[model samples]
Target: MTTERKAARLPVFDRAAATPEQEAVLDEILSGPRGNLAGPFLAWIASPELAEHAQRLGAFCRYSTGLPLRLSELAILITAVQWRAQAEWQIHYPIAIDAGVSADVAQALLEGRRPVFVDTDEALIYDFAVELYGAKRVSDMTFAKAEERFGHETTVNLVGLLGYYALVAMTLNVFAMRANEDEPLPFNE
Candidate 1:
């Protein structure tokens, strides 16, 4: 048997050829906060069922999470950097900064450096996300601090948010989907 390489397939969503299921999912995505069909949705629509579920989860993680948007965006940025998902990074970086994540911290992450966080909450979030990615589990100390600060429901939401964004990152990377090809890449050379 010949070896088959898994070449990168860029997301190319064509509206006219969409199946009924894809059309339904596309409608949901379009009517939501994201008014356009770009990013992971283009890749995800291939499996309309997965697209439907993931989009719901994404909406909850992005919009209804108990953690503030600032913290949620920070976690998303961390996930983006961890996955080296250029599209994810490019999309969320501005949102993170606008939601109160410091420019210095964002820059440091882009450069793959440990940032000196100014806010205690930002530090805690960074530590939590970093430890989770590094060790594949959060240390007890890290978990306790997160629990004490945010409580059970919100902490779960944080984890869920991390998970949802991770899915997004993977989809983006695998499909070679980019938010804007004209824009500079977020990672260092």
Candidate 2:
């Protein structure tokens, strides 16, 4: 029974079988600028029960534009780190860089260090990410401040972004997704 429990604790990716749809999703994601995609991401999308909804959620959370794209990416990056999701962090760190996030800041967040060049806005968002992910609740002060600084639409978008990547982080970690060798991690792989 102990051995069975131990085996159950292992990641699902070890037993994942790639279907045609899974390969297609992986191909699409890898075809993006990053040029490398993790297998677990594709596996999640390939599961018919989760695929369509995952696609919608991914698009709405990441690609939908309104709030500063950079900040949204940064928030997601920070959430990935707080979750200790190496695969999710690896996937988004480059996207954050492409969106104008600095390599130093990315490294700092990944290494459990406070970011140096964080602006007031970025810092507020980071605080929100930490609080939300760590405690699963946002303080009233944080909500008020975010509302005042970013306005309601952006605030809503921020929440959605957080929810989106949090789900991704869980899936990636549970699957133990491997980072593609073709695309190295930011700030030293």
Candidate 3:
């Protein structure tokens, strides 16, 4: 007989089991743009102090940043790809599409191929993010192009968006977070 082993769930703080500080942080997250707590926040709440500040920073990066939703989501998808964080990819892929990223572009990114960008801004975001993640820094030409087209503030926000999502991806990856079973894996590998 073959034996099947169930996947181990990471130790995540539930509202009922939360400390007073953790509950306060959970309440704040529930009331924020996030609406419900899940993913990285589950792991983060274990460290209530860090969770409080991190969630606020995440809310700013995700909601109030200078970059439009499409660009910000694009940067997030790039971060997910870089980290191969399935949970992050699953969460952001639909949001990215809703924000104007094409299905073809998202599919190409999933397959580790160069995406056919439908917009100039999309192309710029992909190039800048891929270069930054792969090279640890973008070349002067790429930086200049991003700054010229998006403005210095938007460019800086894009960087921050990328970094914030990278942190989310790292948390998801470290905790072996899984997406909904109905969702397809973002990458085959």
Best by lDDT: 1
Tens digit of lDDT per residue, candidate 2, span 17-136? Answer: 656665565555556543443424444643744754665566677777466778888998898787676667766777789988889988889788989865788889888888888889
Global CA lDDT of candidate 1, please? 0.85
Which is the better candidate, 1 or 3, if ranked by TM-score?
A: 1
Q: Return the candidate ranking by lDDT, descending.
A: 1, 3, 2
Error of 3 at 19 (Å): 1.1
Clashes of each: 0, 0, 0
What TM-score number comes out for model 1?
0.92
The residue-by-residue lDDT of candidate 1 on 1-189, one tens digit each, is: 111222258434567778999989988998998766656887787899999998989999999889889999999999999999988998898899999999999989888898998788888888988888899899999999999999989988888998899899998888776777789878653
The top-ranked prediction according to TM-score is: 1
Worst 10 residues of 3 by lDDT: 1-10
Q: Which parts of model 3 are misplaced by more than 4 Å?
A: 1-9
lDDT of 2 at 84: 76
Clashing pairs in 2: none
**Residue-level lDDT for 29 in candidate 1:** 90
Candidate 1 lDDT score at position 145 = 98
Write down the lDDT of every candidate, Cα atoms only.
0.85, 0.70, 0.83
